[model samples]
Structures are given as C-alpha cells and as structure tokens.
Target: MSVTTTSRMRHLLTYAAFVAPAVLFFTMVILVPFMRAILFSFQDWNGISSDIRWAGWSNYTKMMSDTGFLKSFSFTIKYVLATTILLNVVGLLLALVLNLALKTRDFLRTAFFLPYVIGPVIIGFIWQFIITRLFSEVGKATGWVLFQKNWLSLPDYAFWSLIIVTIWHSAGYFMVIYLAALQGVPKDMLEAAEMDGAGRLKRFWHVVLPLIRPAMTINLFLAISSGFKGFDLNFALTKGGPFGTTESLAYHIYLDAFTKNLFTYASAKAVLFFLVLASITLVQVAVMKRREVEM
Candidate 1:
C-alpha cells in the first residue's frame, strides 16, 4: 500500500477500535431490548408461557378501556407537572444562593447534593420511615397536628410527599448544572448592569436568566422526564395506596407486567409512555432552543 493509503487505513482501524465497545454495548443492551419490547407489545405473552400469541391492537384497545390505566395516566401527569416545576424552581434558587461568595459554598453544595447521591431505593425507605414514624413523634412533641396524621396513608398528603421527596433528591443535581451555567455568565456584563443602576432583581431577570436559558432547557427536560418515569420512590412510599390514588404510569406498568402478569399489555403501555415522553421532550427542546440567547 502507498504511504497515504496506509495512514488512512491506520486511522480507520483506530476509529473502529475506539467506537467498537460502545457500539457493541448499545446493540446488546438498548437495541435488543427495545426491539423485543416492540415485538412483545403486539403479542399475548403472560411473561412466562411459551405460547406467544399475536394479539395485534388488542393490547392497545384493552389499555384504552382500562379505568385503572387511565387513572394512572392522569396521576402521572399531575406528578410530572408538580415535580418538574418544583425541581426547577428550587434548583434555580439553590443555584443562585451557591453562586454567591459564601465562605462555606463548596461544603454547602456538597451537603445539598448528598441526598442525590443516595440510591433512590434507600432514599424512598428513609423518607418513608421519617414521614410515617419520625414525623409523628416530632409533631406530638411540637404539638403540630398537621404532621400527626399518617402522611403516606392519605392520598393528598402522599402525593405531596412524593413531590417533596423527588424535589429533595433532584434539586441539588439541577442546582449544580445551573451553577455551572451561572459561572459562565460574563462578570463584565453583570458589573456593567450594576453600574447602570440596575437592581439585583432586574439584573437577574434581564441578564442572568436570559443567559442561563440553555441550562434551564436541560434542567426542565430532565425534571419532566424523570418526574413522569418515577417509580421507586412512589412504590416504596405509598405503593399506590389510599385507593390507588398515587399510582403513576411507571408504577402501573410495573403492576401490569409483574404483579398482574399482563406482560404484553404492559409492553404496549410502555411503548405509549415512551412516545408521549419523546413528543413532549422534542416540543420542549424546539421551543426552548429558540429562546436560548447567546451570551
């Protein structure tokens, strides 16, 4: 081979070596399972039986007529809205605070992010105990009747509890993302704004927010997707109790596939859920991308 041809072949080999592992991993884990799910969504498999009958749209039809499925769908939407808003708001506030020149800024950031580092399963169990048992004692001691009730036992309270837990877990994560974006905001611009007699509120509204729109886009997408797909925390906290009021789409999928053994139906629900999340995320990205202003 000529020298140029030999160099090109070497580069190709190097590139293939670098990409092969990731390509193989994705094909085995993600692509295979995704393809299986699509196939299963059209079948009547009980998750165990060898007789996999092709059911076509029957699973989708059954899901539409199922009231429990509809309730879970609505509950998932409520959870998504509440948790997304709260996560972004709290995360932005925390980011703003940490952006300041505090003495313990690094320590405080680590402390806030500690909850996020804990496994979701452990966080769920920890919060479940605290909300159910520990809060009762504290309430009795402090004479706060609001905390005296079974928090996880009541539908409304349980819903809020889930929101609070999700926010507590995720806010720090998004805060870190926002903090990085905030750090990128030009100090000269902020100083000029201050020199022009702009108040802190005005500067943040006109200067900081517009510059940090990219981070907001990312944080919003993360919050919305994670909120809609939340399962472990809700499962551990309430298990969709209080007359199945807290059941989300994810938990419903779990119940259908595992608990009820309706694997094919659950696959259909999963496919629909995936499509809804994808559409919403795409729309959000398109709208937010337009709003992003270069710093």
Candidate 2:
C-alpha cells in the first residue's frame, strides 16, 4: 500500500480504538436495558417467576383506569411546570448577578453550584429533617402558621416543599449554563445598546435574551426532563405520602413494581411514561428551536 493510504488507515484505526469503548459501554448499559424493559412491559411477570406470560396490550390499557397512576402523573405535571419555570428564572437571575464584575463572583458561583454536586437522595433526606424539625421549632417559637403545620403531612404544602428543595438543588446547574451563555453575549453590542439610551431592562430584553436563546433552550429541556423523571427526592422526602398526593410517576412505578408486586403493570406504565416523556421533549425542543431562531 502507498504511504498516504497506510497512514490514513492507522489514523482511522486509532480513532476507532478510542471511540469503540464508549459506543460499546452505551449499548450495554443504556440500549440493552431499554430494549429489555420494552419487552418486559408486555409480559406478565411477577419479577421472580420463571414463566413470563405475554399479556399483549393489557399493560398499556391499565393506565387509563389506574387512579394512583393518574394522580401521580398529574402531580408530576404540576411539579414539572413549577420546577421548569422556577429553575430557569432563578438560575438565569443568579447567572446574571454572578456575571457582574464583583470580587466575590467566583466564591458565589462555587457556593451556589455546591448543592447540585450532592446526591439528590441525600438532599431530600437533609431537607426533610430541616423542614420537619427545624421549621417546627422556629414555628413554635415565633408562632408562625407556615412552619407550625406538618409540611410533609399536608398535601398542599408537601408538593410545594418538594418544589422548593428541587429548585434549590438544581438551580445552580442551570445557572452555570446561563452564565456561560451570558458570558458569550457580545460586550460591544451591550455597550452600544446602552450608548443609544436603551435602559438596562430593555437592553437585556432586546439584546441579551436573543443571544442567549440557545442556552435557554438547553436549560428548559434539562429542567423539564429532570422534573418529569424525578424519583430520588420524591422517594426519600415524602415517600409519596400525605394521601399519595406527592407521588411522582417515577415513584409510583417503583411502588407498584417493588412494593405492590405489580411488576407487569408497572412495566406497562413505564413504557407509556417513556412515550409521553419522549414526545414532550421532542415537541418542546422543536418549538423552542424555532423560537430561538426567531428571537
């Protein structure tokens, strides 16, 4: 073979050697489990028996009449909406503040992002104690009704408390993304807008927002997906308690499969949940992409 051809072959082989492991790992870890789950969704298995009966579409149809499933899914929708908005708003606001030429910007950035580094289950347990114990003591001392009530025992306050913890846990992650996007906004454009007598808010609305649309797009997708698929916090914090009002779809799936021994039914619900999530994410990304280009 010619020297050029031989050199090209070695370079291709080198690249393949580096990429092959990641491709293999993903296929084994993610793709295999997903395919298996889809198959299991249609089978009547107690998750332990040797015989796995094919139940066809019964699993899918079960969701329509499952009150617990419906309730959990509904609550999840509310949670997703609350978190998506709060995380993006809070995250972007933090990013903007930290972006300012403050001497403590680095420390603030690290401090804000610190919570996200901890495992979410740990965060849930930690918050659970604070809300139940610390808040109760403070409430008794100050005679504040908000803290005195059983925050985790009441449906109205339980989900809100969950939202608070989720936003606090995840806002920093979104902030780092927004901060990167904000930093990429052209300094000259911002200065020129200011020179033209545009006020700060107008400058941000007109100039900064449009430039950071890409980041906003990504952040929205992250927040929505995370909120929808949230499990750890819900599992650890409330355990879907207070009349099952705070149970997320994910937690419901676990409860059905492991706790209730409804593995087959849970598998079906999992499949449907997968479809709904995939659809929402796809539609959202498409719409947001169009909006980003327009802005």
Candidate 3:
C-alpha cells in the first residue's frame, strides 16, 4: 500500500477503536432488547416456555378492555400532570428564593437538594415511615386531624401522597436547574426593567422568565418523563394500595409482567408507553424551543 492508503487505513482503525465499543454495547443492550420486545409483543409467551403462540394484535386489542390497565393509564396521566406542574412551580419558587443574597442560601440549597441525591427507593421508604408511624404519633399527641387520618389508606389522599413525595424528591433537582438559569440572566436587563419602573413581579415575568426558557424546557422535559416513569416511590410507599388508586403506568406494567405473568401483554403496553412518552416530550421540546429567547 502507498503512504496515503496506509494513513487512511490507520485513521479508520483509530476511529473504529473509539466507536466500536459504544456501537457494540448499544446493539447488545438497547437495540437487541428493543427488537426482542417488539417481537414479544406479538407473541403469547409468559417470559418462559418454548410454546410461544403468535398473538398478533390480540395483546394490543386487549388493552382497550382491560379496566385495570385503563385505570392505571388514567392514574398515570393525572400523576404526570400534577407532578409536572407542581414540581416546576415549587422548583422555580425555591430557585427564586435561594437566588437571593441570603447568608444561609448555600446551606439551604444543599439542604433542599440533599434529598434528590438519595435513591428514590430510600426516600420513599423514609417518607412511608413518616406518614405511617410518625404522623400517627404526632396526631395523637397534638390531636391534629390532618395527621390523624391515614393518608396512604385513602384513595384520594394516596394519589396526592404520591404527588407530594414525587415533588419533594424531585423539586430540588429542578430547582438547581432553575437556579443555574437564574444566575445566567443578565443583570443589566433586570436593572433596565427596574429603571423602567417595573415591579419585582413585572421584572421577573417580562425579563427573567423569557430568558430562562431553555431551562424551563429542560426541567419540563425531565419532570414529564420522570412523572410518567415513576415506579420506585409507588413500590416503596404505596404498592398501588388504597384500592389500587395510586398505581402508576410503570407499576401497573410491572404487575402485569411479574405478578400476572402477562409478558406479551406487558410488552405491548411498554411499547405504547415508549411511543406516548416520545411523542409528548418531542412536542414539548418543539413548542418550548420556539418560545426560547436567544441571548
């Protein structure tokens, strides 16, 4: 081979050396499993046994009539919406307050964000103990009706409990995103707004909000996806109790696959979930990106 040919071959080898591991892992871990899932969704297999029957569209069709799946779908939608709204709102509020020049702002930020660093399962179990045991004790001592009621035992309260815990667990992370965006806002713009006689709310609404739209986009995406995929908290805290009112889509899918041994049906549901999540997040990013201001 000539010198140019040898150099080109060497560069190709170098590039392959860098890229081959990622491609190989992707094929093995993600692509293979995804293809297998698609195949499984079309067959009647209980995750075992070689007697796989071709299910065709039956699993997909069964979802329409499966009331448990439908109820879980509804609950998941509500949970996503509630957590998305509240997490963003609470996170923004916390970011705003912590952005101030308070002496304890650093400590407060760390304190608030500390929970997010903990595993979701651990957080859920801790909160479960607080709600189940500590709350009862406090209620008995203080005679407070709020703590007296079993929050996890009531359907409505159980639903809100998931929301509350999700927000508590995740809001700090969102706050960090917002805080970073807040810090990146141009000081002169805020001063200009104030000089124009804009009040604090006006300055924030007109100036800061638009400038931080990118952060909003990211936070919204994370919140929506996290809320949709929520399972750890449901598992550790409620276990889809209170008449199964708190069952998230992920939890329901888990039960169908593991508990009921409906492997093919669960695969079908998982496929639908992936599509829905992809569509919603794409639309959200598209719309939010349009609103995002440059510079």
Candidate 4:
C-alpha cells in the first residue's frame, strides 16, 4: 500500500522480467536433464523400452571390470594430454607469427581460422577422404613413402591422426585467443625489456608470457575441455578403429548407450566423466589463477 513498497515491487518485477527467461531456459534444458541423468544412472533402462529396472550400484561397479571402458578412458587421457599440449604450442606459435605485421596478415588469419568454422563431423569426413583417397593417389604419383602409409589403419598412426585433425580444426581458435592476448602486451614493456639488455627470447619469456597469463588460462581451459569431450571426429573419422586405440571417452559412452543398449551404465560413466573433467579443470584454473599477473 505504501509508495516505497510499490516502487520496490516494480523494481523486482522489472528484474524478474529480465532474469526469468534465462532461469526457465536453464532449468528446462540443463538442470532438469542433469538431474534426470543422475536418476537414470541408478536405474537400468533400454533407451526406448518402458520396462525400467532399479540398478543401484551395479552399473558403476561394472565399470571397474570393463576393459573396453577402461581402455577408452586411458586413450581419452592420452588424447587430452597430447591435444592440450600440441594445441597450445602450435596455437601460440601461430599467434606469434600471425601477430606480426606481415603484408598478408589479415588474409593469413582468415585462412588459418577458416577450418574452425567447419563442423568437426564435416572436417573428419573431409580429412578421411583426403587421407584414404587423395593421399594414396598423391603417394603413387610422387613415390612418397610417408603418404603411402595408411594413417588411419594403424593404432599409433590413427591416434596421431586424430590428434592432427583435432589440432588442425581447433588451432586457429586458440591462435585467435593468444593473438588477442599478445596484442594486449604493452609495446613499452617490450622496449623496456630490450633496454634492460634482454634478448627476444628473454623478453617474451619474462614480459610477454606473464602479461598473457589470463589468455593462457582461458585457452588451456578450452583445450582441456574440448579434448575430453572429443567425439564427433572420432565418430565420423575413425569410429574407434585400429583395435579401438583412438576411442575417446565420449565416443565410448556413446557406444555403451547406443550400440550396447546399456543406458544406465553409460549414464554412470558420464557422471564419472563429469566429475573427473570438473576436478581437472578446477585445479587447472586455480593453479593458473595463482600464476596470473594482475595487469
């Protein structure tokens, strides 16, 4: 009844008008499904059938003995490590080069980033054709021993092939992030470092790196998460081939849920996957945040 109460009520309604849609969207799309998945992880159900059964801890316990699941997890960890390191290194290098004032700088940036615009599935298919078809043709024409080898048919090669494709697809994205960070580094700082008798490498190591720590944190986080959740390329390119050496955890989860019809078991694996990813990323952010320079 009072003017103060009426004004407060109006402000609350205005705030709710802006926030309500996002809250509802998150609840329906993410929160609800997440809770449902937790519930499903405790029950056995064919994805299509109505005959659901309570599974308790059986699904989670079974993972301890599942060799294929274990292998996929191991492979995923390796994939994450390889991709994260290579993506960051290659991306940073590309960023450094592209950041330079070259004549074709803008054009080169666009060319490099063009791959990231394509979907992983499409990139996989494209590279699949290139590796399997075009490479062989080129090899025969040029007598190139390197191209003659079947990159996708051998276990080690297949693993590296996946890493190569992942880096090709994503490196430009990471490069853009690093480029922005690099550009943000003060020119005066570099000049000051030079004036202090620091060489190029020393200047970059001491001045540039410390300044770009925020971007490094962001790029590292993206690389780790993207590496862990890698599936589309695995599905479209190799399909976990060459004795399943390149089967990522996400792909394995897909196999269990869709191919094996072990929905509850897959849900359990997904839950564990979430926990592991969350823990690793949290630790990464915490550690990186500590090292980040305020400037």
What lDDT does candidate 4 reach at residue 30? 95
The C-alpha lDDT values of all candidates are 0.92, 0.94, 0.93, 0.93
Tens-place lDDT digits, model 3, residues 1-295: 9999999999999999999999999999999999898999999999877789999999999999999999999999999999999999999999999999999999999988999999999999999999999999999999999999999999998888888988889899999999999999999999998999999999998889998999999999999999899999999999999888989999999999999899999999999999999999999998888777343
What digit string (tens of lDDT, one per residue) describes model 4 on residues 154-216? 999899889999999999999999999999999999999899999999999989999899999
Model 3 lDDT, residue 226, Cα? 91
lDDT of 2 by residue, 1-295 (tens): 9999999999999999999999999999999988888998899999988988999998888788889999999999999999999999999999999999999999999999999999999999999999999999999999999889989999989999999999999999999999999999999999999999999999999999999999999999999899989999998899998999999999999999998888888878888899999999999999999998777
Q: For residues 1-295, write the lDDT of model 1, one tens digit per residue.
A: 8999999999999999999999999999999998899899999999997999999999998988899999999999999999889888999999999999999999999999999999988899999999989999999999999989998888899899999998888889999999999999999999999999999999999999999999999999998889888998978878898799999899999999998999999999999999999999999998899878443
Badly placed stretches (over 4 Å) of model 4 are: 293-295
Error of 4 at 291 (Å): 1.3
TM-score of every candidate relative to the true structure: 0.97, 0.96, 0.96, 0.96
Clashing pairs in 1: none
Each candidate: how many clashes?
0, 0, 0, 0
When summed lDDT is taken over every stretch of 10 residues in candidate 3, the lowest stretch is 286-295
Per-residue lDDT, model 4, residue 198, is 100
For candidate 1, report its TM-score: 0.97
Residue pairs in clash, model 2:
none
Q: Tell me the RMSD of model 1 versus the true structure.
A: 1.3
The CA lDDT at 192 in model 1 is 100
